[model samples]
Target: MYAATTIGGGLGTGLLSFYLGIGVAALLRTMFGYDAWDRDFNATIGYIFGLVGWLMGVGMWGTWGREWFGLKIKDPHANSRKELGWQRYFMFNVDHKVIGIQYLATFLVVFMTAGLMAMIIRLELMGSGQDFISNKTYNTVLGMHGIMMVAVAVAAVVGGLGNYAVPLMIGADDMAFPRMNALSYWLVPPVAVTLLLSPFLGGLETGWTAYPPLSVLTDSAQTFWNVAIITFGLSSILGGLNFVVTVMFMRAPGMTWGRLPMFVWSMFVTAWLALLYTQGFAVALIMVTLDRIAGMGFFDAERGGDPLLYQHVFWFYSHPAVYIMILPGFGIALEVIGHFSRKPLFAYRYAVGAFLGILGLSGVVWAHHMFTAGIPNYLHGPFLVATELISIPTGLIFLSALGTIWMGKLWLRTPMLFALAVIFNFACGGVTGIFLADVPTDIHLQDTYFVVAHFHYTIVGGEIFGLFAGIYYWFPKMTGKMYNEKLAKLHFWWMFIGFNLTFFIMHWPGIEGMNRRIADYPESLQTANLIVSLSAFLLGSSFIVFIYNFINSWVRGPAAEANPWGARTLEWQTSSPPPVENFLTPPVIAGHPYDYGVPGAAPHVTFFPPAVGSPAGGGGGGQ
Candidate 1:
């Protein structure tokens, strides 16, 4: 029956292996006469072992790992393969759709968790000094909120929506490496669990950046935080590689690059960004970890190590990591806009070029994030120019979106409304970004609430809006059911109004000398603080609507038509909720996806097998 390989078995084995890992590290350290009781050293080693155990326990060992040692791999879905409903999602099933749903569901929980932390932060800041929690507690909450939100922003769209849609869009049976795809998703839970457990081990005080000497010297929680993020970065890199490979080699016959859907293009660029640039964060954290566990002097001033080095490494990844997050958001927004606008995508090639442009420019703009961190004046001009210059490509996306909407028959569904908000919200974020990109203004507003406002407007306004759009747009396809349109719209307007209200006022306080990352502010700012806090609660409450709608609709909503949007994309040609192989017949791309109202356009896809031994696309699905 293979009853032991479900999530339950994974948890049991994970706990056992976690203990074994810690105990072995302690034993080895004792033999070497090192500090066996050292929390940082032991925890770091223990986490590595725990991560592996968890992955194997969750079904990887039976399904994939056994192949490494000449043993037959067991079926991952043996226990519940016959039932084939909810239980399959709990194990390491190699279905891209299942993995996508897992990623979405997991990260949605992470998003809400972080959002609640944000409200708690807003609560503390609503008045002044020492409202409830101490400064240390506030910092921990802030850091937790920052990191978790960043995680949600980074993975939710690409892992969740990208996984589910890309293969189907490209007309492939599954990802090029299905087990590896499953592996990337499985890596996520350990990262999340490790991060959530850190506060109990003295908490993470050093914000998401975890910069330099403070991170190097903080308690074991920082160690856990570092390890968790490093694990997350690995997941990102692997997922990126998988996406790059799958899109390259796994496409249907005649699914040429130019004919690829906009969302797929966005993800293609994002995947490259992830594969190539995620190393910046991983390397930075690894140094921090080595410094903590091995007594390395990577950032030790006494040992002539440069503290500024860490900032450089971290932001190098962290900044482009912004694009890594937002590009997919834009991708989703553009996609929904295309289908709902009932018009051909405007400047399609230009939009694709813009994606490539962002990819080319993303790595160079990393230094802009470090301007106020003490860099040479000579370096400032180049970074500022580079930072602002990247906007040209992004601006093309805005043009493409607006152009599609102009003079078109608008279907303002929940997804479309949310998609439209991406442009409106990101326009504001982009304008504020100019101030921060300039050297003088950045020096003044470096750690202020203005930066906070701009950051959220860009990520939450632009990307989070895009995230919701993707959720709504694909809900019918993914669940084989329709959502409540009325409830969905209610959530959209409430969240839109509340989000703008909360973050827009947040900019005023920054301009008025309210430093960010603070638990306290002057009494003069109390009124504005209260308004933002109350608005934040409103923003938080909107998710309740979303949660209820998402659950109720999925469980009891009307069955959806396969081609609900009447779009030309290959995915829509398949059954709603799709088949195990994605298509009853193999799909073949015929022409571009968004040829709406082109009078005599070829259908985007047709059913046929791929040519035998096609060279296919570049890149692989492996990490």
Candidate 2:
């Protein structure tokens, strides 16, 4: 079977090379007067080897890697990418649309997996004193849930919608480097495998933050975690590079920056942030890996290394990582709000500036995460102030959403419902964030269930909500089918209510001194924990509606129109699912995409040039 040769082959060769790398590490370790069977050393070396084997097996070597050795490159297998329907989703197709679906499907699986882990966590907290699982098991579940969701937050919108929509919106045929784009996706399988393998290896003890002294000292599967995240970072960096180049050079004629879509602008800013900062997390983990296997002292307090160094480097990227997750989210919400409200995006230039402002301020606010980490006293106020300052840009974005809805026609569709909720949910999230940004309050709230509530409010409420808005808004364009409207609205209301009740109640318990990552707590807090657990189960069950709706609709839903919402964006002008080149004829820019109500409004785009004195072409000069 073709599947056997691609994904299956990757698994097979990956296992073999993994063992080979262990053997090689053994030989080198023995030669250097170390033990021949060092688990840390062998696993570290094995993962590096395994990653390459996986890539090469999955068509990377034939399609792209061969060039490094001065060899001719080919499709890497016999199957034609022209294969239609669900088959292309499985194949190594370079069409950005297929790759977009691939990322969505992959991360959706991950999201559900992590969501189940969340249910287990909630179940254990249903009773006090570790009744359901050991403290160790609880920590493992918590860590896996945290990290997996972090992965979903980081990649889902950017990798899914960003990939599918950006090229089409910008009127490009495909990503600038199609091979590199494929490589970015192929790299994810190994990272997923590595994370799944960790629980068997000893279970993750530290949280996703992976702070050093504890991270370096844990006897658990830190090496596997380290290698997996580093691989993931490499994938993100490459994807970012591809996006940056594509947006900069591949836009259609007259697709200047000023005329770009909000979604495209968001991706552009997010790509640069990811490209520039993802390495800090990778390099920090690399040092942690070296500390474990190579016996380096990057975080060893006994050595000259300071543990604080890890916090500094990790938070540097991890903080900007917050924007990386939320920026596209805001982009999606803005994009949806613009179309559904039937208005030109209010102060469009200000919204774009808000995105850039976040990008600029994202790095400087890293130290706020470490306010309780025992850094120097003088560093506290500046980081606090900088953290608060970033809110100015965020508020601008928030107000843009509100202003777009002010007196504009409201469509009240599923995507619009989600878009409207984004404004409400993030307002709650932003308020809590302000408390955490202040030194006096954060010192009390840091490491508690309050932080947990605040975090979910920001990420799940902000980014994941935006993600659904996009999925609904683009469902017709991407799948050539219409989702059941009633079911979608059902899923939306259930999820929104459940999510709010669960997290909003979670904050009270934390304020009452309920700590995070603990399996046992005082009997005094039992009542509130019970409420939260019940509400969490309610929240978790709402996804069942989504799973069914997504499956049923995608499989047998009705045919869709090319432009379901009658928007002015270029993507809606193309066929549902689009052709190989995206458009049958190249698109020529004619006017601003969101301009909705001029007396003689020129279409945002046209397949052919328009003639003079045409009322329909009132917004344009002769093409």
CA RMSD of each candidate after superposition: 3.1, 4.6
lDDT of 2 by residue, 1-623 (tens): 66657777788888899999999999998998988998888888998998888888777777777778988887532333556446667666678888888999999999999999999988888877778888788888899999999999999998899999999999998898877788888889889988988889999989898888888889999889999999999989998999999999989877888889999999999999999999999999998888887779988888889999998999999999989998988999999999899988888899999999999999898989889989999999999999999989999998889988998999999999998888888999999999999999999999899999998998999999999999999999989999999999998999999999999999998999999888888988899999999999998999999999899998999999999999999999999979777877778887888887756877789875433443241221367
**All candidates' lDDT scores?**
0.90, 0.89
Which runs of model 2 end up more than 4 angstroms from their true locations?
76-84, 609-623
Give the lowest summed-lDDT range of ten residues in model 2: 612-621
- Which lDDT tens digits does candidate 1 get at residues 1-623? 23345777778888888888899999999999987788887787888888888888888888888988989877643523536568677778788998899999999999999999999999998887778898888889999999999999999999999999999989987887888888999899889988898878898879998987999987649888888899999999999999999999998899898888999999999999999989999999999999988989999999989989998988889888899889998999989999999999999999999999999999898888788877888899999999999889989999999999998999999999999999999999999999999989988898999999999999999889999999999999999999999999999999999999999999999988899899998989888899999999999999999999999999999999998889889999989989776887677778779888888888888776655654355442376
Superposed Cα deviation of residue 210, candidate 1 (Å):
0.1
Taking all chains together, each candidate's TM-score versus the true structure is 0.96, 0.96
RMSD of 2: 4.6
Question: In terms of TM-score, how similar is model 1 to the real structure?
Answer: 0.96
Q: After superposition, how far is residue 410 of candidate 2 from its true place, in Å?
A: 0.7
Error of 2 at 334 (Å): 0.2
Least accurate stretch of 10 residues (summed lDDT) in model 1? 612-621
